[model samples]
Target: MAFAVSILRLAISTAVFPIFLLHFLGLWDWICKKLFPHFMVQFSKSYNKEMAAKKQELFGNLHEFAGSSGKLALMEVGCGTGANFKFYPPGCRITCIDPNPNFEQFLIESIAESRHLQFERFVVASGEDMHQIADNSMDVVVCTLVLCSVQNQEKVIQEVHRVLRPGGAFYFLEHVAAEPSTWNFFWQQVLRPSWFLMFDGCDLTKESWKPLEKANFSKLKLQHLQAPLSWKIVRPHILGYAMK
Candidate 1:
């Protein structure tokens, strides 16, 4: 009787342990969804502001779109919490794309605050598959700090090329693989596995700019930017515009 009872108890514990872990993970994800957006929005404020100025200096052509008689169509992949809304010029319409549906309310609030811009729509779509948007429609495609987490970076760039009208530009800012034999590079590799797991699939050592070079854009330009020491591990970044 004692031996039978011990065997049964062990079997029950084995079965229940997996079930408990599964539920615990699901609950943790739920909590993260509810809280992570606010943290992302807050942490991005200063970085976004500084980058906007530098971006304008690098590609001042965007200013030409301002105050046009007709609205210039723009698509922003991974438009998290609409952090870039304030930086857009007047007489532009924006189409926001993000995989996380939880960001819709935050985006709506951001749109309301942008008096110069018009909100075309928000699609809960990943950058790799922007099928809902019509081809050759967007005048500009903005991708800032986003390529780090995309499942297929090349596919996303191809979609950007496809949706852009002739003379359109794809503007991107992304953290890239650090220089070899450096402390930052070493730390990036060491922390990548765990970091990717914690931070929505963001890989530390992805050479995000390589695919942009392969794409047959009419003009392609890239400039390297130094990240703050506080973010040293993922500090090296590339920013540029690719004209279609």
Candidate 2:
């Protein structure tokens, strides 16, 4: 029995070592960037449908900010593949930002299909520091499923607030921590380390809404719901608009 257990352990180590090495060497980042967008299509479809009405209520009439150009200046931090483009209101000039440059190709393709949105630029920057965007310049700032992976959630929220013009809205949709006593929460804790390794720094146990509630948003409207996703671990979600 002891000999059999030793062999099984060795086998497991042999299978996992190569993946650990790939992650240490940054190849895992490349793999995630290349494949995560495609993997998210079905989830995005269900989420987009569920949140369509809320998005319309938030973005439908932006003419209020349509200064001389008649277009709202919007920035999407961590804009992976521009998945939210189709849901945006008309006449929006969008600036996309992400830490992974590999997503630029996929983002460009998404933009090509979104004829209603005007292309501003894609910047290789992390949400924690968006100095490339001027303070008080954006009419709206949007983020979807991004905060959980950021290095510092509070800093990112502050940067989002800083970049938005006075009265501009910051729209966000994110998966957050499950209830403390739930079985899902227990699994979230158990699976977090491996999940983070495989999914580009996403933390399954992050209570992302904590920082949002603490942020200095002049007006905040947040709602929590279980997203229609096959993965139960990531089903708990929060979506809302915060006014600066």
Candidate 3:
């Protein structure tokens, strides 16, 4: 019966909640990679050339940027597994930050292989707190599927604004809450509590579009870009950019 299944789900989530709390404290990503390296690897493997090509097309068009020749600096907050590595401009410097202990090593190793692009850094820092870097120090700030887990999304937006120069841009791809329907809403409410446990601090339903709009930035450009905007939806990601 539906009631029995709901009870079973609740019981499972109740058991997993504590561990999730620790994950929010930045523990689960490490454990998932350690306990299930292949799973994590498989996840990364699927993030293939096509996704990178799409990202390149979108961001490159948004910023009118294609490749790097001079000394330009790029940074990605919450850079998971460094999938954005390929998109890094040749002959440019890149920095990535993520709190996942399991990812830090892999990120460094993976990105360092790019002969044309230099790995400037990859630190374990919260996206909201990039105060250590000087203001207006970056040419571009990139974020992809990263907003869901951040505890203070507002602060992160502020930090992005702070870090970019006046003409600089913040390019992003984010999944968010969708329009309500009967069955989709029903299951999202039911499974989100349990499902969030497995994702690296992802939220099934997040209103992530507002922060960038409200931030102190000029020339905002957004696309309501989540595929399957209504049906069988999980990662209804909003992807776009804002000029700072």
Candidate 4:
């Protein structure tokens, strides 16, 4: 029995060693970044169509909140491939932020395609610590499909609030934990470890809306719904805006 156990351990170690080596060499993150943009294209098309009305309501009148420049100063944290750029109203001066610098090329392509938006710059920074952005500077903050992968959701929310001007709005769309006692939730739990490993730290079971709820926004409008054309594990989603 002991010999059998040792053999099983060896098999498992051998199977995992390549993954460990990729991570150690920083190639795993690079691979995920390269592939994720392509993978998200179809998902974004479906999600954007389904969520169009809500996004319109959230962003259509953003010019009303514009400062002296007649443009909304918008910042999107974890702005992978700028999937939400097409949703913003015209004349938005947009700054994009993401921890993975590898997404920069894709982001530039997205910016080029989003000609109506004025690209401010892309900052390679994490949402949890956006010290490069000044406090009370942004007119609007946006995050989509980001909270699940952030190392510290609460800290990210805090940073969002800190950077936004008083009365500035924070918009978000994120997949969250499915209801307890459901098959999807069970699978979410079972697959979470491998999902995290394969998808660049996305926790399949994160209750990402809790931190948003507790963030003490002046006004909050959140809706829980199922994401259309999404994987079963990521179907439970939240979409809304909070005013700072």
Top candidate (lDDT): 4
Q: Compare candidates 1 and 2 on TM-score and give the better one.
A: 2
lDDT of 4: 0.84
lDDT (Cα atoms) of all candidates against the true structure = 0.79, 0.83, 0.72, 0.84
Q: List the candidates ranked by lDDT, beginning with the highest.
A: 4, 2, 1, 3
Q: Candidate 4 at residue 82, lDDT?
A: 84
Candidate 4, position 71, lDDT? 83
Which is better, 3 or 4, measured by TM-score?
Answer: 4
lDDT of 4 by residue, 1-244 (tens): 4454456545654666776578879888778777777766666777788777767766666676677777899999999888789888888999999998877888888898999999999999999999999999999999988999999999999999999999899988888999987877766776665567677789988998788889979999898988764467788989888998
Lowest lDDT block of 10, candidate 1: 59-68
Error of 3 at 225 (Å): 2.3
lDDT of 1 by residue, 80-188 (tens): 8988777777867899999888888888888998989889899999999999999988889998879999999999999999999888889987888899777677667
Candidate 1: stretches off by over 4 Å: 1-32, 49-52, 65-69
TM-score of each: 0.84, 0.85, 0.81, 0.85
The TM-score measured for candidate 1 stands at 0.84
Candidate 3 lDDT for residue 20: 68
lDDT (tens digit, per residue) of candidate 2 on 1-244: 4454456545654566766688889798788877777766555677678767766665565556554566889999999878789888777899999998877878888899999889999999999989999999998898988999998999999999999989888888889999987878867776666677667789988898999899999999898988766678988988888988
RMSD of 2: 4.7
